[model samples]
Target: MRNKPGIKLTKEKRAEMISAIKSYYSAEREEEIGDLAAGLLLDFIIEELAPEFYNQGVQDSYNFMEKQLEDLLAIQKQ
Candidate 1:
């Protein structure tokens, strides 16, 4: 599997995520998944779902800057 540089998780964190995912499947779906399956699922989530989250973060930053600029303009108007 080609690793994604965009999503970097420490080894401990990676293991935690994989375990959590497996646990979620076991609890919610009543299905048992092994480490390999959990790892693949985590990879898929990072690759597919993370972009939407990243885009939202970018958009939020843009909006915050815009609000700050507006505040600065108001201060200048004073």
Candidate 2:
């Protein structure tokens, strides 16, 4: 993935994500991590993994629109 600027989240959203991360670690790993650690993990994910996911979503949307355009063209008068 290209080096892109860090993703920005609203304060509320960041808090929500940090909570989710903490919950995931508690439930899945049986470990308790603090807010700072959870926030760091969130930063790592956003910086390293989010671009690939974002690219896939963009590709999927493009493919869907392309198919829809093709279908629309098929109905045009000859």
Candidate 3:
């Protein structure tokens, strides 16, 4: 199947990109570590990578769970 307009990468390519980013984040850096890598990850996801079925199957579920926990915490706080 052809890639859609918004998404620039194939599913395998996206996974590889994400894996590389994650690995880079895990490594210790000379300068600011977590902040820079995290910002890059967020930007890449928001801009470059397009969601695929497999990506949705994994990432979306985790994001939903995280948001649910965050919401629950907010409710408890209130």
TM-score: which candidate is best? 2
TM-score of 3: 0.32
Decreasing lDDT order of the candidates:
2, 1, 3
Candidate 1 residue pairs that clash: none
TM-score of each: 0.87, 0.91, 0.32
Best-performing candidate as measured by lDDT: 2
User: Please, what are the lDDT tens digits per residue for candidate 2 over residues 1-78?
Assistant: 346686789999999999999999999999999999999899889999887999999999999999999999999998
Poorest 10 consecutive residues of model 3 by lDDT?
Answer: 28-37
What pairs collide in candidate 2?
A: none
Error of 1 at 40 (Å): 0.3
Q: Write the per-residue lDDT of candidate 1 for residues 1-78, one digit (tens) a residue.
A: 556677788999999999999999999999999999999999998888888999999999999999999988887743
Q: Candidate 3 — which residues are off by over 4 angstroms? A: 1-7, 29-78
Question: For each candidate, what is the lDDT?
Answer: 0.92, 0.93, 0.62
Candidate 3 has which clashing residue pairs, if any?
none
